[model samples]
Target: CPPIGLESHRIDDDQLLASSMLRHGLGAQRGRLNMQAGTNEDDFYDGAWCAEDDGRTHWLEGDTRRTTKFTGVITQGRDSQIHEDFVTSFYVGFSNDSQNWVMYSNGYEEMMFYGNVDKDTPVLTEFPEPVVARYIRIYPQRWNGSLCLRLEVLGCPLSSVSSYYAQQNEVTSTDNLDFRHHSYKDMRQLMKVVNEECPTITRIYNIGKSSRGLKIYAMEVSDNPGEHETGEPEFRYTAGLHGNEVLGRELLLLLLQFLCREFQAGNSRVRNLVTQTRIHIVPSLNPDGYELASQAGSELGNWALGHWTEEGYDLFENFPDLASALWAAEERKLVPHKFPNHHIPIPEHYLAEDTMVAVETRAIMAWMDKNPFVLGANLQGGEKLVSYPFDTARPLSETLAAAPRPPDYEDDHPELQETPDHAIFRWLAISYASAHLTMSETFRGGCHTQDVTDAMGIVQGAKWHPRAGSMNDFSYLHTNCLELSVYLGCDKFPHESELQQEWENNKESLLTFMEQVHRGIKGLVRDQQGEPIANATIVVGGINHNVKTAASGDYWRILNPGEYRVWARAEGYNPSVKTCSVFYDIGATQCDFVLARSNWKRIREIMAMNGNRPI
Candidate 1:
């Protein structure tokens, strides 16, 4: 359920006017008010001592009741004061209808008060479990001659917040409007709607909650469970882990709506994938950051609100170990020299690292652990690059490395043959570059290949560290998942026009990239009989062409096409080697092999008779 707001009423007098004036001084603007005073009155006031009129009691004669709408759960400030007079008491009231009101705070009426007209003071208030309220009012009792009251309301209005993002301006009108842009609230609404509309394949689960106590939700989309007897290989896409990088969230939402509608309409490809592969998505991993970023412009407030310490300058570089250490030793202690640190007084509250890891990263890691899917991609922005693991410089942890290499007939271990393949990763890199690069051939010149050993090392050494507990790294290293982290662009939020155009231009390519990854994974391993071979060694020559097969006889490697020899060898058989021709097919192919046994006895007799056998 969504968090609700609280409403309060105040008696108008000199003190109230003074308090309103003071609020205006503190940047609080006057809101719309409802009054019951007679029309066209110059100044509607009953002398000093006003009458306790019936309608006046609730609606206040000539008195205006202004309302402030907050989107989420509201909390008061701590420095709150009521003019020159000290606040004696304050009580919060709630009502389903504007007409009826009742005291809703715990029996303890006085939440907090101040001695002087100084800073705003926050009052402790708690909403009922699963808060769902339309109206909340606060009544403050004054200590001086006239009772002037004011209640500082906190939290955003869920209704307005949700509706504000219902319809977003697209890059172009031709793009489907049903692919609605979404915010945090829209994500929640969309999930509920999706689940209700397509119960068979749509499911909404709580991965965890954000630092601000907002539920971190995940949606799983697939065909009816039994469509594929063995829960099909899964593919995952996640977005919004960094609050400011919101385009992915919007794209994710659009994707979900698109797939759901297509599936319901019996779109063959959509149906096939949904029924054949489980697709799980975490649209917004950092809801708190999302809301803060949405409220505080993309760049300004995002880095300031979480467990971040550094102020003023951007904290984007804080994720890496070196930056974190530098920040802790220097920037963390240095307050923003330009502005007061009142907004983010505590370093932990501002840095966001502690909260981001505990809340967002943990949930994502847990989910990856359970699914162990074949393919996963984490979408981020600010770089036009696609990266793969081991993004952190760790050695490849897959069991294929330990399995036997192909009977090299030259390299050391001929007895232990049939390891998994590594070409899938290389192919994954080339295919990705082919599909997404603005300059089709440019990526080929740069660092682009899925060879974890060499490719990831260069990526890390180049300071690309999307690897710290990254969902992609977690999926690949910890499970049998082939993962990649995709950077949409090299700059922060390109112009709306450019972003829309880019997405339009790349939609087909993006889909193609996914399809290629799927196909690449499927073609990694097979036996001479064309049967899927488990634990087979598939090697491609390079700095080091080595890979082992999985229990399913599947091996994934990424590589570029050139003259390369592929060999398959097993014990009790003559090693088979072939100069295989492999290239980017833009489609699928079958690469299987067979091995013949070596006749040692016949060779021995021939060698003894001819005296030509070399021991």
Candidate 2:
């Protein structure tokens, strides 16, 4: 069953103002409230309290639990029973105890936030930065009728404290690779400390919060921390889609720590990778589920409890159905030249206002939309193999099925739907599998007796087992990203003592997989005038799929070792073709393109100037 108010967990903006605010962890009615000298705490709710006209010092305080980290406050004026009484303007004060208080200041002056005007509509005010405080005081400076209100505090529990000792020594030390599961808060603190330790090369930011309001954090390590440089490929590794899949998440954290330490110690490979590529690692996407699973511990417990989001949705299958939309277009012959195998827009229905996509899914979709990631992989557990895209087995729509089809369709493999880049995808899968210590073993007695063994430690996702709305398929079809699903091991949540071995087994493979992003051809596309052309299409000769250059006119295409014709096409410019080859040992083949003004476009312009004369 879904939790109370789960239906209202949509985040449309920065401020949550209505009664719906309570659904987003703003629980004021349940907090301890303190009133001014002459006012009763109950008066702020039903009855109205007015400040003296002289205004010496009158306020109301809402104090949350001891460890709550305060982000902001949401306040409702008096209820309709009162005469539209409300605080018009207010100053906020923060305090750990009720004794010492500090006013929220804008450097020099104390900040004043405007409150509600009506009796029902709530108003919100956020702090400049998040403050860990138990008590927050609202001192009203102005009022409509009287300074009367109800209050709600906005924050999650302060997960862990950042200690000086940890930040200075343990954070950047490669010696202390702790082999344990980090709770959501602990993971966040670790990332924070890492960022602090390596401020120049590391960035920590949240994508979005889970249904339970825990942040989904992504840490980026690059030459330039937050900015995406020109011609640099963006690669990401995401883990913890199923909350019980704990190994991947811990491994990612270890990878983060290792990268930080190695780069600081001037490790050439780490420094080169950071300098040339933008690497983003999202350690845990399902923090709420992870919390539940971690609480239940790793000793052969019920594996299904925290496999889904707290809202009872499996995030792996929660993305919008994009594959069907693409197939429908191809079946209808709507594609003019060839089927669009890349950057397929999401279905209109999925983006509709009333759609019920999980918050985590929406956050990641938005994240992908912003980053032109060239390669990615979502790490999972419960298996020990690497799987590539098209993880669905459903038949096409009735309209699509009725159209004329090829004769080979009857003999086609329905279980596996390969992408246009199937060869490269397979190579990618094999790369990870080959690097892992035991993934390639024919039969290591399986995870359990009944467990199935994967041949060569790699397989197409749909062939393994049909599942829809998978992140790998979504990334391949809907964006410029080629993503894979790598199942780490048999146990979804291994015992804590086994973590060190698991890290040793997977560490080299993780680094090797990240290094693979630089294997393909990368270059900039520009016009004859030497101006970079944004949104230029990069098309491989035979492959129908296409990818667009990034905002910086830079593009990256991962290809297997071969010679091929590649074209760069942009509006108002003549297309340019180049032959690029990837070798077995070479890192990346540079293939830059410079397009000229289109002759046909020039003729059209001349004809228009000559009063529609034919060219």
Deviating ranges (above 4 Å) for candidate 1:
1-173, 178-181, 225-231, 265-269, 298-357, 393-471, 490-502, 521-615
- What is the alpha-carbon RMSD of candidate 2 to the true structure? 19.5
Indicate the residue-level lDDT of 98 in model 2. Answer: 76
CA error at residue 99 for candidate 1, angstroms: 63
Per-candidate TM equals: 0.45, 0.67
Give per-residue CA lDDT, model 2, range 327-395, as digits (tens).
Answer: 767768876355566787788888887787888889999999999899999999866788887787647
Highest TM-score among the candidates is held by which one? 2
lDDT of 1 by residue, 534-557 (tens): 445555544232344445554444
- Model 1: weakest 10-residue lDDT segment is 27-36
Best model number under lDDT: 2
